[model samples]
Target chain A: GAGVSQTPSNKVTEKGKYVELRCDPISGHTALYWYRQSLGQGPEFLIYFQGTGAADDSGLPNDRFFAVRPEGSVSTLKIQRTERGDSAVYLCASSDGQRETQYFGPGTRLLVL
Target chain B: AQSVTQLDSHVSVSEGTPVLLRCNYSSSYSPSLFWYVQHPNKGLQLLLKYTSAATLVKGINGFEAEFKKSETSFHLTKPSAHMSDAAEYFCVVSLRSNDYKLSFGAGTTVTVRA
Candidate 1:
């Protein structure tokens, strides 16, 4: 009965550093997604995973952003050479499958200084 | 491509008054429309969804939305507003062809006055 969960509710890092945000989806969910929400804006899609493999990574801004769900349960979003523009709330969601309603987790708020 | 637009950036209504949040969408295919609400420092909660089966859909917390194909609109409405309804609401759209991705509208902030 647990909902999706994300660790490091808030993170502050200097520019050019690297950071990792973790997500733990619902117990039986097989589809996972990551999104970024900037101030006063809607959430932007980043990446999605169906099982252990990423089904779609088109939304990743660039090479500096990557995600992995190695064991098909937990996921980690990795950012390299973080920039000020990367400062935002990183959200994670999961569903039973591609067509199911996705449930969200309290996001990780990242700040780059 | 798929896109959603929330017409009002903010809506304020007195408690017990009717509430409306407008949304318009454009899509290349039959789209699945949804309404999500987020409280401060909290995750988004699904209000309801219209998946092409029914035009009018009812969601939690006395909220509902009607999907109108003629005007390309799916507006959220509640017969009476409650103080707890004050929060940010987002209109979302996703096409059947791209079910895995969601296109969200610039959210509408709702303020319920007592």
Candidate 2:
């Protein structure tokens, strides 16, 4: 069985640019989550999806950060007008459903210069 | 508000010695507590979790944590330390409201010495 997989393990972009990170959750997992971790800090929640619709987007810092799971299996986290402060590791995780244990992916390290 | 706190930012122990990582949490409702480990250049892996069903919970790699409601703590412990146990550990909490969102603590970096 394969675990959650994330593409573009690392990304470097200039400020004001845009980037997209992808995540493929485990099969049959209906709940997906995204988080960000800064250097020397724990991960902070960003957004979550239950099936094709977003269940929570309160954690998104602003309009620049948006995520989608249109097909209910794969997800994409899009960031626009990236800032230096946006530099961090973006993590993705999935669970069977709400209240179930979530498994994590390797994450994509984003650097905005 | 719900929050988690890791009392120690770092813990060092000799191989074969006991290991302890302190964590405290505050939540209005019965929360689900979890311990996750992340080695260098890797993602997080669940060591163990306590969902209010049992006070004491056992996890992988010989790690364990006890949820103490009186003191609002869920500290991780291991009888023996292994070289591979050196990594960053995070304590997380989710309220009983059925929200899958987790609130994470700063994290504790464990170092193992031979």
Candidate 3:
């Protein structure tokens, strides 16, 4: 059984740039979530998707952050006009839609310089 | 609103000694609680969870946690510490009404000494 996988284990970009992080959930998972972790802090929720729809986006910090999961499996987290404050480890997790334990990915560490 | 707190920022135990990491949670209703461990540069791993099935839940690597409703606490414990157990442990809580959106604590860093 393959766990959640995130691409670009590490990404470095300049401020005001745009970046997209990808996530591949388990084969049959219908729920996906994104979170951000800053240094010396725990992960903060971002967005969540159920099937192909965004079930909850309230955790998203601002309009600049958007996420999509088309066809109910793969997801992408997009950040627009990234700021230095946006630098952190972006984590993706998936669950079986039964409100069970979430399986997390290795995460993509983004550095906005 | 549901939230969790790891009472200790860090905990250190010698090999073969007991280990305890305290965690407290607050929720308007019955909540699902979980403990996760994360090694450096690694992803979060589910240590154990309490889904109302059992008050005393056991997890991998000889870890266990007891859920105390009277105290609103779910503290992780292990009979003996292992060097490989050194990592950051996060206490998480999720509410059924909130689509199970998880709320994580600041985390407790455990250091197992030899």
Q: Which candidate number has the best TM-score?
A: 1
lDDT of 3 by residue, A1-113 (tens): 88899999999999999999999999998889999999888898898888999988999999999999888999999999999999999999999884767899999999999
Query: How many clashes (backbone N, Cα, C below 3 Å) per candidate?
Result: 0, 0, 0
Query: Candidate 2 lDDT, tens digit per residue, B95-114?
Result: 87856989999999999999
For every model shown, what is its TM-score relative to the native structure? 0.99, 0.98, 0.97
| Ranking of all predicted structures according to DockQ, beginning with the best and ending with the worst | 1, 2, 3
Please write out the lDDT profile of model 1 over residues B71-96, one tens digit for every residue: 99999999999999999999999988
Candidate 3: segments with Cα more than 4 A from true spot = none
Indicate the TM-score of model 2.
Answer: 0.98
Write down the DockQ of candidate 2: 0.82
Better of 2 and 3 by TM-score: 2
For each candidate, the DockQ is 0.91, 0.82, 0.74
Measured with C-alpha atoms, the lDDT of residue B32 in candidate 3 is 89
| Per-residue C-alpha lDDT of model 3 across residues B11-33, encoded as one tens digit per residue | 99999999999999999999989
Docking class of 3: medium
Q: Which regions of candidate 2 deviate over 4 angstroms?
A: none
